[model samples]
Target: MTIDFTQQALQVLQIEATAISQLARFVNDDFNKACQLIMDSPGRVIVSGMGKSGHIANKIAATFASTGTPAFFVHPGEASHGDLGMITKDDVVIAISNSGETGEVLTIIPVLKRIGAHLIGMSGNPASTLARLSDVHVCVQVEQEACPLGLAPTASTTATLAMGDAMAVALLNARGFSADDFALSHPGGSLGRRLLLRLEDVMHTGNTIPMVPTTATIKTALLEMSAKGLGMTTVVDKHGVLQGIFTDGDLRRILDQRYDIHDTLITAVMVRNCITAQPQMLAAEALKLMEQRKINGLVIVDQHQHPVGAMNMHDLLKAGVL
Candidate 1:
């Protein structure tokens, strides 16, 4: 007996897709009420489940926690052993079980109620004991399981996960959660770095900035660019105001024109009114400007139009903004 793996995989996908689509109907008043309960709670949301449900519960708890709702997962088995103490009157408990008859989860309900905690149940059976006992029940029922044997948690788990995501996102929008707020919770990740890093934080400042007076020769500008290793130098006037910019590209063009690099003034060949950026601008935004303008470097200027700092594509790459 040979199994056509491709056909079986397609069947599983079709079954799960249908299950997710069917879940849209169940996102009615009960789902809104569940979101309200979680939003109003001053304490954390405690999520618990058994077996495969337990794994999904953990992920759901993490999503809630990261999206502005304080939450954590507690295993049903552990809750029975003593972790039930983690629940308090100020918290909301979300219990998960496909059949809604998981022995360990059901056993801890009476104690949770006694502790004045609110119970929210997610189950496939609305008539199950867990759902009946909950303050609010979320139905995660599916027409069938993706498992060919009609066993195992497949489509059911996918629907349950989607339902949890919907709840978390609803609450997140209700609270007006922003990307910056999300970044705070994920400070160690790439998103945090992209949102938090500023141009000033990574730009070469002080003596490291490649700059030359307008009176300086192109040769002097090249020396500054070489010493600073930024491939560019800002040309300032006598009053220290930004006059123009000279780069290696400009040098190549100047050489093609046969300009006297040894004696020609930088002001004669530098690109005047060059693109500049503020120190406070985000590095990611600066990278966008660079790509849009087809430039590799930017001169950081203050309000007085004086060059204060300098940075290039290499600097942004080193700062993880590339």
Candidate 2:
């Protein structure tokens, strides 16, 4: 017998996609009740299952933990040993079993009941043992498994995982979880840097700021821009108050006018309405402002409008804010 690999793969994908689509009906009142139980609990959420369900349970726990819900996974076999000690009555436990009668998962049901932990069960069978024992049962009943023999997990696990995500997202919305909150749970990489980094953290400070006095020549401003390498220079008054900004772009535009850079005041050609940002503004927000203004650099200012710091697109790239 010859096998068609692409057709087989397509069939599996179609079944799983259908499994996900059928999940909306399961997101009914019982789902909200389960979310309420988790929200009202004083302790964390515990997720547990056997085999393939265990893999999905682990990811679900991670999603909950990353999204401001305190959660972790415990293998049902491990829970039977001594890991059950990790769970408390205040915690809510979400148990998974496709058949709803897995021996290892079932073995811990009475213990969970005795401990008074709120139980949310996920099972493909509504009439199964785990579902019957749960405080709230979420049915992940799929029409069929994607497996050719209907023995492997396939579509059932996909539906169960989808339901878990729906639960986590609903709870995330209910709790008003924000990007800042997510950054706290994940502070290791570009994701954290993007969310947590502020303009103050990356801007060049004090002497590095490109500046030329209002009385200075455009030639002086160009020299300062070269020394600072920001492609721009701030034209300020003797009082150290910002007056305007001159950029290499300004130089290009005024080239045909034949004005002598050697003698012309920078304030005469500088952008008087240049945009500025606060030192405390988010680097991400600064990036947006730069794009919107179609400018390359920004002067960070204090409340008194004195330049406190400066940054450009290259600085953002080096800081990984890009």
Candidate 3:
């Protein structure tokens, strides 16, 4: 008999879906209390488990850390040998075990209790040793395993992970954590750059900006555009305030009208009502406005609307926002 991978995959998915759905009924005061404990802890949340549970615990710890909570994963087997020192009195411990009788996890219970760390147990069996020993028990019990043989941890781990996410998000909401706050914690990622990297940070400034005086001939403006390579040049007045913008589009329009580029005044053919952004605005916001307005470039200006910097779609792409 040949094994059907598709059938096995479907069974696993169905089993886990049922397990997670059943968890809805278990959301009660105890769940709220567990969240409160993690939220109130001054020290980090230490997650510990063994085998498959350990892998799930590591992910849960990462989720908590990224969502405003200070958390780290500690392997239970390692904890017994010496890693238990990482748990301080001010910290909270989250222990994971499907059966709640993992020997490595159980070995550290007394030590964690002795060190004055608050214990929160997550297990499939509420009456198991781990749950009974903890200060609070949040049951992640599943009716069945997604594994066809009912041996591998599938549904139980999925449900446990979902419950961990709920805890992290619940606490994040209670703490009034904002996108900016999350960005501070994840400064290297694209989302972080989107939230924290301002237009001023990525825009080309100083001589890199393509500029031309309104009174300049189109031939001179083309020289500035060529020097800057922004494919466009900003037109300004005697006071250096932006008047209009001339791009390759303007050149095409002038040529179609049979006007000589060398003889034409830039301001006469420049595009008015040009899109602009402030120096302090987020790069992501500038990108959104450009995309929504169907434009490819923007001039960054100061409070007086004087052009300070300039950027285009390519700039955003170079900054990893594309």
Best TM-score among the predictions, by candidate number? 2
Question: What ranges in model 2 sit over 4 Å off?
Answer: 1-4
Q: Give the Cα error of residue 168 in candidate 3, in Å.
A: 1.4
lDDT of 2 by residue, 1-322 (tens): 9877998899999999999999888889889899999999999999999999999999999999999899999999999999999999999999999999999999998999899899999998999999899999999999999998999999999998899998899889999999999998888999998888999999998899998899999888888999999888888888888888888788899999989989888878999968999988989889989999899989988887788888899999998989
- CA error at residue 192 for candidate 3, angstroms: 3.6
Candidate 3 least-lDDT 10 residues: 247-256
Instruction: Report clash pairs, candidate 2.
Output: none
TM-score of 2: 0.97
User: lDDT of all predictions, in order shown?
Assistant: 0.94, 0.92, 0.90
Compared with the true structure, what per-residue lDDT tens digits does model 3 show for residues 6-28? 98788788888899999987788
Error of model 3, residue 59, in angstroms: 1.2
Best by lDDT: 1
Cα lDDT for residue 314, model 1?
95
C-alpha root-mean-square deviation, each candidate: 2.0, 1.3, 2.1
- Those runs of model 3 whose alpha carbons end farther than 4 Å from true positions after fitting are 1-3, 253-255, 258-263
TM per model? 0.93, 0.97, 0.92
Ranking by TM-score: 2, 1, 3
